[model samples]
Target: MTLDDLTVSLRALRLLAADFGHLPAPDVDVSTVFPERLRLSFHDTSCESLAAFEQWRTALGIAPDAVEARTQSEGRTRVLAAETSFAGAVVMLTAYADQSAADRAGGVR
Candidate 1:
């Protein structure tokens, strides 16, 4: 996805959040070139939001197609990665542990 594509995708997510209200707000950073990496870092990971995204992906039947991966987790830190396509664009949801453990993990997600 190009920068423009990234913008449109984020707008769609924001709109979806408005409707469902459980989707976690995204903090995105994108590059302008090809081989775009759309990394969505959710600082405040909530169980409800994670479940909502999982259910949404499963309902779309993309869960199986979606790649499930794990991030580095140790101590009191936890990280999860769920990759699913949205509007034909590859979207990755990365959730880090709660605020308290963020420091030790060094924002590992």
Candidate 2:
């Protein structure tokens, strides 16, 4: 993935966290990028859980179609979605967080 792709992915995950946190405790946060890993559980990764493996796979696979792209800061912040395709199709969403800010404030996410 390019730097641009990594940014898009970051914003997408931030959005996902905000959206998902409303469900319950054990909020899912953006775990990693480059390879794009999302921590699917609050428990340990090595725990011997029957459904953990499948859950992890599902989190990485839920890209929505029509990956929309948008900028947040003065052309610095960028966001993306895998929603370019029609509904029911897989979204290959991706993002970029602004590196510098005049006020040193990060974008809204």
The model with the greatest TM-score is: 1
**After superposition, which runs of candidate 1 have C-alpha atoms over 4 Å from their true positions?**
1-22, 33-37, 45-74, 98-109
Q: Mind giving the per-residue lDDT tens digits that candidate 2 earns over 1-109? A: 4555445445555665575544323333433343344333323222222133233224545434433545555655544433222122222333334434542364332
Give the lowest summed-lDDT range of ten residues in model 2.
82-91
Local accuracy by lDDT, each model: 0.51, 0.39
Model 1: how far residue 76 lies from native, Å: 3.8
Give one clash count per candidate, in the order shown: 0, 19
- Each prediction's RMSD to truth: 6.4, 16.7
Model 2 RMSD vs true structure: 16.7
The Cα error of candidate 1 at residue 23, in Å, is 2.5
- The total of clashing pairs for model 1 equals 0
